[model samples]
Target chain A: MTAAPAAVEARDLSKEFDGRTVVDRITFAVPRGTTFGLLGANGAGKTTTILMLLGLLRPDRGEAQVLGHDMERDRFRALQRANFSSPYVSLPHRLTARQNLTVYGRLYGVSEVRRRIEDIARELRIEDLLDRPVGKMSAGQKTRVGIGKVLLNDPEVLFLDEPTASLSPESAAWLRSFLGAYRDRTRATIVLASHNMPEVEAMCDSVAFLQQGRLLEQGAPRDLIRRHGKQTLEEVFLEVAEGDTGRQQGPGDLA
Target chain B: MKASLGRIGAMMTRYMYLYQVSPIRILELVYWPTFNMLIWGFMQEYLRSATHPAVFAASYLIAAVLLWDVLFRSQLGLTLGFVEEMWARNLGHLAVSPLRPLEFVGALIATSLIRTLVAVGGAGFLATLFFGFNALELGFGLALFFLNLVIMGWGVGLAVCAILLRYGLAAEALAWGALFVLQPLCGVFYPVSVLPDWLEPVARALPATHVFEGMRTVVQDGRLDIDLLAQAFLLNIPYALAGLAAFLGAYAVARRRGLLMGTGE
Candidate 1:
């Protein structure tokens, strides 16, 4: 019998803008129900890579597939079972969280949308903020609402670009725990892109460090630390950034 | 692929929710159309006494102004739906959803229909009250004129959205100014024959020109010009289809360029 397909796969994916390569021929596969991190500094092509996987951006070469559907041609099929969220993107400011949630729920074709919104609001601990306009909410509240939006459909594959990039530490920690619990409960495959090493180490099953639009290295956090003789993923990130030895490391073991 | 009406309705519902919160937004929709109607109505009254009264009927100017608002308001409504998504920075979220680009365009068109009716309906009611000129009296001619103008408006509105998608927020001024550039060419206030010899061909090529010319025939000749109405619709087939193609092309380019990821004002 054939092995089960990876929940997410990128085969030699690449992109460029204005003569500058943003994501060079990178390849990876994320197993079902696992949390994978794309750790990178700013301008390291983390967001661009996620966008291509979400089919919000087209790769200049190669393929991105989610749930065995080609992202470029069959994205709608994957999108039906997927959702994306980022603090950098926003909901309508004039709309209350409930209103915003209801709209997206309907867009995703959720049954009993009002009930789903209440359930998500309760899960995200956003019940009190439901009637408040998104613009009136603090950053933490908005991030919760954003997460609530993602969870509305109970997506099988979730793409999050810097999920807690702008939150305070306390809020970030709370969100990390919330997501960890969410993954445990739903068994959803999550692709998280962030530069925060601790967050990546805490939440990810495996991670790949990207530098200057290229994949520097990818492995289990602890294994990467052990392999590079480093104490933390942060130190490993620095070493990988300075060295050019990861061109051979691929997602072979993960796939 | 088959489009989902439920998704389209959901997008429309989002805009309707916006109106529910902002009374100012609702009021702005009707304010301009009504204001234009009243001003032109009073001017027609003045022209009745000052100029050759028999040269143009009393209802001619009032009807022209009312009909013209349908096109302007409809185009504004469609573009406003798009611009609102940009301002909210919600396009990125929308792009990743199960929503298709054409389905989103369908929502914009449907929302514009609702908006155009509210604005032009309110203004037309006022036209009947203030000028004692009932637009409804034009009968089937009114439907013909309304249909052709709205189609042309949607055609132009879609092209504007294409430009906005490709060029970013800097080109937003086209939303308001694009249709106005067509007004003088469409002969909203005068006959296309009154245009200079070199410009008449350009005027005649526009779908709105046939619509306004058709309106003038109803008002001045006291008869609906079926031939002109047919010509307007035939012209709209290409104009509207071209706009749809342009919008889809721009959406593809935006996807390739990753513009949809961060499009905002």
Candidate 2:
């Protein structure tokens, strides 16, 4: 039987700075065509791990493989098939949304780039603001533009760092539902790092619990909740977050 | 090999087009050459009183100021490019991309070459229109302008970029200051004869000084000196090579040190 492709697989990954272990020997594997949520409070090395996986950071020891490409040897080829998005890194402020997308699409050597730009812009619902400078857009508008820019090349592997980070509750819900639709259509492997536990419970097929750069547990969110005997994922998140998994609570608690 | 060359060609074309069309980049393109030539024009007027009687007055400073920019602004481009990446947070993305620092530097060099042409072209135009200094009329000086300027300018830029990459925002302002330091030492605005006797040896040691003096010699009197050209080749080859070496060394160090992460905050 042919083995299933691993979207991201890391072994003995480590990164240290000035004698401090930031991500200490962490390893995990994410299967393709599913969303893997990495959960931890801040400073848990969530971002660091993502950076290493994306080939943005190098590990001091061990092997990392992303999209079947050895992290060190063929990262560029791997990165060509992948794209990452984050709210923190702003797209070029001077360029209009359309201009920014075209520039990156060309850099990525995307075929039919003009068509791809218009299509991603339409999907992200920023067609109206396509000509507006990115700096002039609202936070929500900029977020959509950032998403559109990342989507312009139609990457096979997508990583979202706080995908719906700063949006209205209603808007975030619409965004989540839109992502659900996009996933159904593309089967794109999404590895999202987020603290929105409901988003995780609502969207993820599997969730990996991370604490202090260590994977504490991995299972379906629903199955983990059922096993923990919690009424809601939030209480489960609290229980896991507090290291108090035996507690009982209702779904209303997190809401 | 051919396919990779195609990819590099495509990237080079796309970015060169992007930077060329960018208003900010265009401004960077036009402003320095315009300003430096203006400054040189005024200085030439002042020094016209006591220049080489055999040669014309504008010859010394105009060519010197213009030559200095090739070195100074090219160095400045690398620093500003680093700053722009830091601002855009695109530096990390590029680093993570299959591009090595050399490829990244290659694109910047390409951009610098384009900018240098615009600057030199603009400077030459102004000198002709405003001061009647047609390099084509001078013959061969135009070719050396491209050769001496682009090559040595790129070397200076690489060195500056090396320092900027290793240090955080602290030395960025040095980009503007470098020309100020290099020019006086190179006698770009004045003849090396005007300096103290000891400084003549220092001026001879710098290739830029030779290029500037050679242009003055050629442009003013329609004469070329093989000795000055020889001196320029000898001095520039080592500095340019050393600067490029320093730049690559800094790139390796920055990659290891996480300065390339753009986390100066």
Candidate 3:
């Protein structure tokens, strides 16, 4: 049988700043409708790689395609079908959550923007906080609003950077469940970059670990744990990150 | 282009929402212009009485104040718009969206135009009430002069934003200070001829110099100097183009350096 096409594909993607490499040559492919996790510690270049995939940061070498569009040459075309969210980035603080949603909705060219905002707000259980200024909302509330903003366009590909960083355990659990359900319902692809090991293990169908800008290993969470002979993904993560280089698989060897 | 409009309008809506929520923001926009108009009105009255026979003294000063605000407000509008995104840490969010850099800059220009109109409108009203001078009395020339000054403001504002983009907050002072540096050089309140012989050519190089000189012609000669207007518009094209290039260049550097996410506190 023929293989399904990739929702995201990168080949030898690399970046450097001030003579220090931030993202080394990393190759990976995320098949359509799958959840792929990018796991890395601080300065491991998770955010840089995500930015490159989104075409917000140009890679110094190699290339990427998202939703089958070349990220470098046709990013706008790809961007229309994708959306991103991060706790580090925020909506205008002074605008009410509803206003923020409306503005982003309009920018994404969504029809019936108000209705879409309402639907997403309802789905995310943030309807009550919709009228509150984003600055006044709690971190958890802001996280939910950020997710709602990403969902406004019903994107085919979702790029998330530390999406649950500031959420409470309950909210984080709820988000993971919601993302799983959303993925199943729409068969959409998700590229998650997170430091949350448990969250990655639970939500990601496949995971890639990065160490100092290099792809240390990649595979299903279970496969990685088994290969590293670890009890959990976090232990495997620690093993890879701390330079306990074992028989780890390379890029595109996830299967 | 249609997408550009949607993105641009969305950006403008973001600022409009800020203005709507904060009465202080709206008040701030009107306050300075109104205050300047009031102060200038009294000064103009003194000049008219002291000069005794000069019919255009009050009109000239009021026109200068009104036109100067147009330039100032337009520039501030664009710079502050960018600063707001930085302050909110929203640059990364917008960067990943379908909004192109050109569209983002276009939105800043559109937002600046709106801000310029509101501020200049308030000041012009104050000028009319306090000094009995209608800057609009300059007729169609007023529109041409306003366009020239605003375009020049965009040029300067874009360049300042570029500097800030590349250098971060340490360079933010340029947003406010850069324009003032040009104020003396542009002869906003005085004739370019007043400058030393060595500096006259430097003053003449600024589009605002020709704009202000054109304004003086309208006020004193009671007729538009098509040549001066043409020179102002011509000079503005290069300034505006340079501003655009500078901004695009800075944006490229910021992207490559991954500086967009943390530009503001």
Candidate 4:
């Protein structure tokens, strides 16, 4: 079998708002068929970077490519194969789950749109909620529907913005397994943004720590723990965030 | 070009379909047009009972009452469309896509046309049933009158939508108030003969005043005064073009400012 290229790649990507650089020049790569968890506190610019990757925001300098298409130019082809989901943004409350899914399916130009809708609805276990109005559904129900919409197109790169924010522990567990299975089946690259270190350690192939729009460190969970000489990933997160740990080498130093 | 057009078509179809399916939006569509029709219909009754009235008043009344929404409802249609996007926080979804500003504007413009047709058809049907006057008074003059009303109405509506996008839902009232100014100034409900001299010049500047006045003059009198028609055309074309520029300009500004927080929070 042929080796796959990276799902997402950035080279010295930067973004500025009114001359204030919010996203500093940073470079990273996530291989195809792997999940990259972005860890950061509030206002850490994780959201901004995700938005830029999705082509919702343009960088002032540098470049990013998503799903092998340039983020700045040729983004339509990139966006066409990609889909994003977040709890903060909602679907039309006036429509039933089926109707909402159908609209997005048509937007994606997905073939067998109805079948895809049905399949996702069942996968999300939202079969009963299909007929009910979106606004009338509970938060958990909405989240489920939101996730279902993202899957409708079988996106090549699925970006999740705080997917489990309001979800119960049980629901979160169920969702993690569901997402894992889906990724295994489709080889879809995922970018998960969350503040929870434990979830990132469990779900991600590699976790990238972010703070103040800068990537502090990136590595596999076990490797990070070994490097930090910590008992747990949470301790490793705190030490690195607090500037007590990280950087085994100095300026001009290489491993 | 073909792909962009296809995407535009897809977006337009989904919006229109969703509009028809949404009960509240459809209700607003019906409520606003009929609400104004009732007021004008009453005014028509009062004019009929008054002293020797302007001849061909019935045609003027029916046409004005039926087409007034071209000014308010079409613009309001676009405002409401954006408002829906804002409320659902789906603006991000659209913003991230490879959607061009042109395609977005095309979708909005097409919606305005659909909304205008619905308003015109609904009000015209009501007027014909209630006043026994025709909405479709097709003649050489009537065609030009229609050209003036629909085209210019859409342009004004687009300009209003620009304002709505910059502001928010609380400002949707401007779309309604737009009619208040245009109806009187345009002489849609009355003859320009009655408007005061000072106000007449200002009205002359508003293309709607010329549109409704010209429509009334033609459909009622069966005479197309080339000067009046030309005045209407001259005024409406620039405003419509200005409206188009304003729409694209507003979109650009929104993009640059990053004010597109769909939640409006």
Judge the docking of candidate 3 as incorrect, acceptable, medium or high: medium
Which candidate number maximizes lDDT? 1
lDDT at residue A68 of model 3 (Cα atoms) = 88
A10-124, model 4: which lDDT tens digit per residue?
Answer: 7787877787767788788999989999888887878878877877666677788998899777888888888888887777777778877776776677778788988888789
Tens digits of per-residue lDDT for model 1 on A1-255? Answer: 987789999999999999899999999999988999999889999999999999999999989999999999899889989999898887889999999999999999999999999988887778999999999998778888999999988999989988997788988898899888888888899999999998999999999989888988899999999998989999999998866534344456335
Q: Model 2: what is its DockQ? A: 0.30
Winning candidate number (DockQ): 3
* lDDT minimum window of 10 residues, candidate 1 chain B: B1-10
Model 3 spans with C-alpha error above 4 angstroms: A242-255, B55-58
Ranked candidates, highest DockQ first:
3, 1, 4, 2
Interface RMSD of each: 1.1, 2.9, 1.0, 2.4
Candidate ranking (TM-score, best to worst): 1, 3, 4, 2
**Model 4, residue B9: what's the lDDT?**
70
Estimate TM-scores for all models.
Answer: 0.96, 0.87, 0.96, 0.87
User: Which of 3 and 4 is the better model by lDDT?
Assistant: 3
Candidate 3 local lDDT, A125-233, one digit each (tens):
9989999999998887888999999999999999999989999898898999999999999999999999889999999999999988999889999999988899999
**Colliding residue pairs in candidate 3:** none
